[model samples]
Structure formats: structure tokens, C-alpha cells
Target: MRTLALRGGARVAVVEAEWTDAFGVVTRGRVQLELRDGEPGPVLERDAGFWLRGTGVRALRNPGRRTARVRIVTPRTRTVTCPLPNTWRNEMSSMNDSGVVARTSHTSRLRGLAGIGFIAALAAMVATTLAAALARAVGVDFEIPDGGETIPLPGFAVVTGFFSVVGIVIAAALLRWSARPAERFVWTAVSLTAISLVPPLLSGAATATITALLGLHLVPAAVMIPTLARSLRTRTD
Candidate 1:
């Protein structure tokens, strides 16, 4: 019997010599399987049992911002202990000093993400507002037929900020549970941005209004998506 501990964002290659016939059970946090071709496989949550033999799994990765452990059982009677590297040992020792270390580390990561999201939201708000003002200056009337009222400049900022925060929330959720968070976030954000264009087209507004609306929608999406995706990559990778 042995225990394999993985720190947050840690990846350990599977050595056939050592892992042969060894069965592993996840004891804490989440672990993502890395396939032979470097693609991601399924994530195993707590209490999940798995066998890596003949599975073509290249590595085990801890996807969450906390330590994860796996209990390994072999057919042999002798016990084995896999020692962590010095850096990992130091980290583990600090974590052992206080139970709150893991929680604090997780919270600190989220707080950094929140800071990045706030800056991106503010930039998006300013960008969309400026773009709207520019469109109006160029004779693109900010009218929507559904509301029968002109969309104000401040309205542009408000809408942009709201949607940007939504993107931030999505990014945070992905960071918490996803193995390839940045890639997934980009795909999701881009698809939603594409969907958002449909409403402006069906609004029965003039060509210029629809055009401006579509561009405005894209402006904020452009601002928020890359920013959040980059931040997620930095944190997860």
C-alpha cells in the first residue's frame, strides 16, 4: 500500500515499471487523466477507483487549487512509500502546519482571479461606451424597436459591465472544476458571443443600428474573453 500526493496543478507521469498492476483510489480532491496523445481524459472525483494498467493514461493531474491524494494498493505484501521532491515536501509541510492553508490558498487564487475580472469588466465598460458614442457620432441611431426608445450611452456601459461580470463568473466556475479551463472558457465565450448577434439581427432595427449593435456586442466579448482566458491559464497552468 502507498499514497500518491499531488499538489494543486501538479502533474506526475505514470511509470509503467512502478504502476504495473497497481490500483488507485482517489482519496481527496479531483484528478484528471491525461491521455497518451496529450489530450485530457475524464476527471475522477473523491472516492473514485481506477486502474491505469493498459489504460494508456499518460499522467495524473490535480485540477483543483488544493492537494489531492490517491491510495494505491498492490498485490505484493511489502509496503512502499513514494517520497515527494524537496519543493513538494516543503509545500506539504506548510500545509500540514495548518488545516486552513489549503482553504486560504484556494481563496487567494480566487481573489486574484476576481481582481483580473474586475479590471477587465471596467475596461469592457469603457470600451463599449466609447464605441457606442463613436457609432452615434457617425449617424448610427441607437434605437431598438422592441423598447421604442433610444439606447443611451450609459446603458451601453451598464450592459457591458453586467455581461463582463457574467463572463468572469463563468471563468471562475471553470477554474474550480475544469482541467482545460482556458480553452473551455474561450470556446464557451465565443459561442455565446455568436449567439448574442442573433438578437440584433432580428430586432427589426435599421441596418446601421443592427450593425453597430453587433459590433458593440463583439467589443466587450473581445475584451473579456481573452483577459479571463489568459488569467485562467496562468492560474491553472
Candidate 2:
């Protein structure tokens, strides 16, 4: 058995002949499988073992910020030891005929996306709060006829901040699990925005109040939906 250390974002092309009868276990960090057809396969975390025989796995890539290591065990007759850099080059050249290439994104990109998403959420909250304040100044009392209580400015800020953070969470989840995260996030956020409008229309408030509430709902959605979708596309790396 020999260990292969891969730097973050490093890729190793797989040569079927060389890897025949070999099994590998992820000993550190994470490794993502890149299929022969250029599509992504499963991501194997630490302790995951896999065999490449008869599988269309084209390459293994390090998908985290730190280095990843894989322990490979081959048949006793085929066991060999060599410097990793030279071994990687030899394997890559051997697979030249099959045109297998590695494809993966780094973890740092995902972390950057999270940072940007949080900032966007804060900006959306501020914009929504300002919009509420402007509406109040224009004679929208923001009063609910049901209980005769006026919506406070602080309430607007608090609710907008809370829901904006919720949008960030949904976007982050989609980024982690969805294959087409940007498109899926857009669809989900738009659906939620549409649903939010119903509550205002059913609040039994004055027409001006209902309109202001509807606009407030849209204000945050407008800021968040596009921002998160754009970030998702970029951080997909």
C-alpha cells in the first residue's frame, strides 16, 4: 500500500491499466470523482473506500482547501512504490489515449460565496427597512385593521433581517446539494416570494397599507434572489 498526497485543487488522471485491481481509501480531506464523460461523480470524505475497476471514473481531485491523501492498495503482484510526482505524470501520460481529465472546485470558493451571501442578506435587510420608512413617510400607516395596531419601524427591520438570513440558508443548502444550484435557488426563492404576497392581501388592511406591505415583501426578494443566484453561479467554480 502507498499513499498519494494531493494539494488542494489538484487532479490526478486515472489510467485503467495502472489502477487495475487497485482499491483506494480516502485517508484525509475529501476526494471528488470525475467521470469519463466529464460529469461529476460522488464526493468521498475521509475513510471512504472505493474501487475503480469497471467503473467509469476518469480522475480523482482534491476538493478542499487543505491537502488530501488517499491510501491505495494494489494486488500483491502489481504493488509498486515510486515518487508521487513522477507517478502522477506517468499515469497521466498513460491515459492520454482515453482523454481523461480532472474537474473540481476548491473549498475556498465556497467559503467566499458564503461571505458574499451574508453581506447580501444584510444589504437586503437595510434596503427593505429603508423602503418601509419611505412608505411610512408617504402616508402608509402600516396599520392592521384586524387589531388596529400599526407596524413599527423596528419590526420591519427585524423581520426583514430574519427572513433575509433564511433566504441565505436556503441558498447555501442548494449550493451544497443541488446539481443546478443557481437555477434551483431562483425557482425556490421566486416561489416563496409569491407566497409571501398572499399574507399581505389577506391582512384586511387599507389598500395603501396592503400595497406597501406587498412592496416590502418584493423589496427583499428582489435584493436576495438575484444576488444569491449570481453568487451561486460564481462559487460553483
Candidate 3:
């Protein structure tokens, strides 16, 4: 037995061997079969097995950004068997007299979600900064009574950038572990955003300043939540 690892977007061609017959089981991540005609075949999730002996499958490709692994088991003997499409999905049947069969499936795709989350974080930072600038331009003096400190423009940008990155980290973590990442991330982010508003309300600032700060708190959330959720939904492999 041996293992092969494939990074996202990597492909490995299958060549016929004279001395060994190999069957592969997806040990981690996903592997998509490439048909001999050059079209993509069904994606096999972890634990899925395929016999490479006669299957029309020309290659194995990793469909996501994470690394995928396959365990290859080769037999010392060769025997004549029925022609099986190289791109067979689901299970590999035993060719013994008993004719045993097995089948299974798995679901996950996080690399795309991480990429999208990073983009969303950048957009959220920009949007948050622009919203803060717009508020400042409209005569909102961001002076807090607690510290009597006026919030600077750079302060807004720095804070927004920091929190936006945090949002991305949260999203990536959920995608890695959560069964329903989109729903779970939305719920967690929204609850945290709500909690963040309390600090602005307790700042004892002027009503205008307090309201503007609250809106600023929301700007990053507005940009991040929907974008991350959409990516999670649309990019599931």
C-alpha cells in the first residue's frame, strides 16, 4: 500500500501497469475523475473506492484547494476481469465468486470558502472605512464622553481591518469543522455583531456620534456575513 497526495487543482494521470492491479481509496479530501474524453466525472469524497484496472477514467483531479490523499493497494497477481469504466462512481465490486459490493460517500469543500472569505474581508475593510468617512463628512463628531477622545479616521480603518480579518478567521474555522457552515457562521457573526453594539451604546457619547458608531460596527458585518455565507452555499464540493 502507498499514498498519493494532490493539492487543489492537481491532476494525476493513470497508466496501465504490467505487474500490478491497483485500487484506490480516497483517504482525505475529494478526487474528481477525468473521463478519457476529457470531461470531468463524478467527485468522490473520502473513503470512496475505485478500481483503476479498466475504469475509462484517465486521471484523478483535486477539485478544491485543500490537499487530497489516496491510498493505493496493488496486488501481485493479475487476472482477466470485465471491462469497467475507469470513471466509475460509488463503489468497487469484488470480482470473487461471491460478487461482494460496497458503497459510501462524504461531503466537504473548504479551500474555496477560505479564498472567498479573504476577499470578503478586504471588501469589508474598505466598506467600513468608507462608511466611517462618510459619517465624519456629514458633521458627526465622534467624541465619546467616557474618554472625551475623538475617534480618528485611521483609527476607524485600523479597527475595521482588524475585525474584518477576525471575521474571515471565524469563517474559515467554521468551514473546516461545521456540518452546516453557512448557517452556523451567520448565526455566530450576527450574534457577535449585536454584542459589539453594546460598547457604542455604553460610550455615553452624543446621540449622533453613538448612532454613527453603531452604524460603523455594522458596516463590516454587512459586508462579511452575506458574502461569506453565499460563498459557502455556492462553492460546496
Candidate 4:
């Protein structure tokens, strides 16, 4: 195992071989993965990861001005333990970290995708509660209880949990079967969010109520799409 760091603005060329690995975690700034065919692969935000395998990719380039760090392993069978600087070390660790062969992204991206999406959805749910509180504190009493006469905090949470799980299920399914999971996820999420707005729109609430509901409609999507997309970012780490 060898560690390789790319300083800001540095670029690396891919070598031809049966299989080669350059595992990278964003140590400081962003790094853009580019294919030889000139496609945008992934954006490694701080602590985000990506990989360069075989000669499929043309080069790894530092898109940001700040230093970008990466590690390389000569033999793909060695166990790797180090984490990307600021991300969850244990959680972000991958199958490759155990020195085992893993399937390509084309075969499936869902193995870990659901967990990531769920975490993001959890965050979004909490954010919704805060947003509601903030709105009420400012005297924007835009509450419209469709399910009951009382504000169901537990019910809200349950619904959030359910929708989040739905997002995860969709992600996992697409990754296992679809070649373009990110793109597919984005469209699906957008369509679902739009469809969800219909119920709230016709609930006969005030305009402000409708506006607030729309905001709520987009909350899950705000979290789910990015989470799914990040999960699709390939990494050998």
C-alpha cells in the first residue's frame, strides 16, 4: 500500500494495465474525477472519496486551488484503514478496505447507498421540525393538520421515517439494476416531490399554508438526491 497526495492543481495520468488502483479521500479541497472520454465522474468534497481503476479513466485532476490528497495501492488485495480527513472513518470504510474483490459501479451501487441516503433523510426530518418551530416563533402560524385536529409530532416523525426509507429503497433498487443511478434518482425524486405537492395543494389551506407545505415537500428531496449522488461516487478506498 502506498499513499499519494495531489497538491492543488496537480494532475495524474492513468496507466494501462489489467487493473490498477488509486484510492483517494479528499484531505483538504475538492478533486474532480474525469474519464478519458471526457465525462464528469464525481466531485470529491472534503472527506468524500473516489477511485481510479484500470485505464478506463484518463487522469485524476485537482479541480480546486487547494491541495487534494489521495492514496494508491499497488496490489488491490491489501487492507486499508486510514479515513478521509474529516468524514466518518469507520462508516466510510469500504469492502476494498477489507482486501476483497468488489463489484464495479456498473454492476451495483446500492450496497452502501441506502445507509447514506437514510442518514441524509434523518437529517432532513430534524431540519423540518426546526423549520416549523422557527416559522411559528416568527408568528407564521401556517399549520394545517390534514390527518387530525392536533399537530402530530410522532406522526410527523413516522411519516418522515417512512418517506426516507422509500428514498433508500429506490436508491438501492436503481443502483443494483440501473447504470445511471444518480441521474435516475434525481428525476425520480423530483417527480415524486412534484406529485406529493398535489395533495397539500388541494387541501384548501391558505396561500401561505400552501407555500409552507411546498417548502416541506422539497425538504426530503434536498437531502435524498445529494445523498444518493454522493453514494454513486466510485471509490476504491
lDDT (CA) per prediction: 0.80, 0.77, 0.72, 0.60
Native-referenced Cα lDDT, model 4: 0.60
Quote each prediction's TM-score: 0.64, 0.63, 0.57, 0.51
Of the two candidates 3 and 4, the one with more favorable lDDT, higher being better, is: 3
Q: In model 3, how large is the Cα lDDT of residue 113?
A: 66
Q: How far is candidate 2 from the true structure (C-alpha RMSD, Å)?
A: 9.2
TM-score rank, highest first?
A: 1, 2, 3, 4
**Candidate 1, run of 10 with poorest lDDT:** 96-105
lDDT of 1 by residue, 66-165 (tens): 8899887777937546533454334434542112111123456689999999999999999999999999999998788886999989999998988888
lDDT of 3 at 149: 86
Highest TM-score against the true fold, candidate: 1
Provide the global lDDT of candidate 2 against the true structure.
Answer: 0.77
Residue 78, model 1: lDDT of 74
* Model 4: per-residue Cα lDDT over 146-204, one tens digit each: 75353444555567778888888887776554435557777898888789889878877
Q: What are the root-mean-square deviations of the candidates from the true structure over C-alphas?
A: 8.6, 9.2, 12.2, 10.1
Candidate 1, residue 178: Cα displacement in angstroms equals 0.5
Model 3 over residues 15-72: C-alpha lDDT tens digits? 7562136767777877777778998766666767666555566788987668889777
